[model samples]
Target: MSIPAEKVRERLHALRSRMEKKHIQTVILWDPDNQYYFSGFKAISYSRPIVYWIYEQQTAYIIPELEDLHAEENAYTDSFHVYHERYNKGSNDTSFLDPFIRLLQNLPSDTRIGVEYEVMPAYVYQAVLDHGHDVVDIGEDIIDLRSVKDEEEIKWLDEAGRLSDVALDASFRHLKTGMSELEFDSYGDQAFLQAASEKYPEVVVGYENWTCSGIRRSAMPHLHSSTRTFESGDPVVHSRQVWINGYRAENERTFLFKDQATEEQKKLLKLAVDAQQAGMQAVKPGVRACDVDLAAYEVIKEAGFEDYIDHRIGHGLGLSEHEEPYLRFDNERILKEGMVYTIEPGIYVPGVGGFRHSDTVIVTADGSRSITHYPRSYEEMLIE
Candidate 1:
């Protein structure tokens, strides 16, 4: 289990406390990440709804019969309201909401319910209204609590960081001149999956962003890898993310392909590394999140590449990949200890290649600690 029953119970206790403070009689969670965070049950809900409804003193999971067995063993709460096929053929009267309503049989009609409206499905939101329950948006509270990583969560984040670096090392070993981006990507994925499978085969090895090559088309950040082969000195902006349990971490490095790189290529890559480091250094308790972003942005801006900056420094990464405490100029949220996020500063020159170095880091009491420890120096990244 990703989170032990005791840990899950502890989290539930926290939620109950928040509910008491807010006068929330019940809190219904529809977001998969939220569902996974509180309960250990992981499932995507759209048609077949998987809900976690917690009242002041009661907690139960209204899940589909298909996942009943899994939830029985994994979920922290024992009160499961499992339902079979409620939508029989085209009968709208017997929709999945019917089963959900049954789960709330004990809930009072005037009970103040809390929900994550922004991420909750429209169908589920409407069902709550139809039931005429008093609902309040508790999205901010949920986001606030999730931003801070607990000890166990930090452990998984570290594991993800270690395995991701191993995968990148294997990819570099397999890399050669004239290799196509797609071919190299396959090898990189294989390495990541291999490392993850050895410990937990069910763990997912996937990237939130594509493994962009520094070749012609690779200058475009977020572009999918094509058949373009790496030449002698191509600067490939490689970024990857892997998930263990429910936590994820990313490791990105700009590699100098089999051939030697140009002076300009080396210069830009160094700047990117420096900018990323600056951003990471700016992370610590009490500092504003935007300061971290500005720290990196200033590095690029001072280098006369302000226009090359396209996106914010980086965002928070956790259960859903991108969470709150976003590192951006407009966001003034104070950085707190135990908050883990990514700092990726890049300059994407249209004609030339792009240079980006992303790392998952955590805010500490005194400073910051990088979970992703892959080498970022020009010497380590610039391969021959």
Candidate 2:
């Protein structure tokens, strides 16, 4: 197994402890990430609906027939209740829900079950209810647990951060006029894939990139890379998220082409850089999550461009692209040691375009250290 057996046991122990405290006899995990967290098995796709069930004494998984061998090899579960699809496997449970419902019906009527309220499908939830067992939410407990990164998770984050910088360096090296957004992204993808293959051999590594160039396109926060070619004087928002061993590190930079960028555009970009610095500086243990957001927001507010700000300063980053305990204005959650976050403060001006630089940071015992170290300065970002 990629994850140490002891590490998986530690995680299961932690969750089971929470379950015991809440009198939850069983926990049904619906989210793929959550399932992979407890069991070391992560399928390429979840269209078959893999479900993880955690009980006091043991753990189990409900998966399709095709994944039976994969689960046996990777999953740390004690048992697997597989549903078949092929006609030759007749008389066996034909659908995922068939085994799921059977399991629910077998549970004691008075048993209290735990489930992810937000992600569990309505029909699946109703089936649990139909079984006459009491249900409670365990999503918050899992989120709380995952917010703090373990040493092993942190190690992978560090590697992911390093790989992200490598990809960004390659992308920036190839930056020039007339390159399509998709073409720009291809340079980084190829570079990253080559590097990962050379270094890690059989390790799982992947990335996602989106390049928004020009005034109108860059103004929008999230957009897929397209065939649109870059023009001179355009503000470009290049975002890249790299993952190694399922741990992700987000690195983004907004750069301006050396062609007719207005004075206002220069100021906005600088403001964004300054705001990101403040946000990064404010990330430390024992501080409120909102404080980090406000530190960055105050920078933008002082510059009278607060209206251009739309999203929060950042969010937690780990096994998932975006995690919980986000750095938002209203979130009062205390930042803890070992927690990972992305410090991304952005401004989207209608005419000036978007300016934001994101860096993944890990909260240390005293302060935090950024993992992504790509050149984000305005001078360096100006592609000549």
Candidate 3:
């Protein structure tokens, strides 16, 4: 679904207020997701270097000729400057940097510009400095702005969550021995695409899936789906991230082949489920982020499986697959209502395989509720 223009206007107004407090004159958003958050435009790829400019009075985009019409149709920017590629438009700006540098020169000498320090390219950062503009890191401010979901944003996230559950159901329904990991992922891909097309015609919907099968692959946590066939007792970790209209929901499940599953494998899977539940139960407004992680960590620790833990309990989720304000042992950020997160506490044992289940959750007025609701119990995960 298209983002409401009123939402974009409200976002810009809020950002400009932040800018005024910081005494910043302009902001350059290099990250595609950040650009989308502020301007309501996102490109398929940024290989050609699309730049978004947020000024005190107006916002603008510097894009390639190919995206001139696309940006005009989707963007909420006040103006756009087209950079050309073909030889026919030689007189126009040839490179993205050409227009970017020109625009920087137009600003006042002492203009305090804001940029995303984590993602802005060094050359781009240097260009602003060379033109006598001071740059401040506004990345955190943008993260804070996006961390809380607005009513419209939450609606899209809810839709994405429902779609993810649908995809997982399709994948698990066709699970069987001998199918390749890629083949297993294909079942859900087909189901997800068909469901999205039928339910929301013309709305932007996409997904990513990876199936790590067998003990070795599943133990590693992150890997692409391979052609290796599922064995009689192979443990499989299936991950799917679904996005609709730029908002994302992550859903994952680790299942065991019941035919030849070991007792230890079953126990490990149960621990993972218990840990995830603990993490979810800990999520509420006014709770420290670290407290949530520790709540889950303590579950595995009490079971003597603390050594198997390799990652944090969860992370903030929204426009990006993984966002800031993570739920980690070191993070002390307080949880707040309207914030969305993934509660995924994982354990990877060398011989037992990895066990984890992830579900996207939104922090409610009092506690939290998971949006992706595929069955996750040990009994439900056992695939015969």
Q: Which pairs clash in model 3?
A: none
lDDT (0 to 1) per candidate: 0.80, 0.91, 0.91
Off by over 4 Å in 1: 44-47, 86-95, 103-106, 200-209, 258-263
Total clashes for model 1: 0
lDDT of 2 by residue, 127-150 (tens): 888888899999999999999999
Model 2 spans > 4 angstroms off: none
Error of 1 at 343 (Å): 0.9
Model 1 lDDT on a 0 to 1 scale: 0.80
Clashes of each: 0, 0, 0
Please report the TM-score between candidate 1 and the true structure: 0.91
For candidate 3, lDDT tens digit of each residue in 137-223? Answer: 999899999999999999999999999988999988888999999998988888988999998878888888899998999998889
lDDT of 1 by residue, 115-172 (tens): 9979777877887887788889988888988999899999889988887888777777
lDDT of 1 at 84: 66
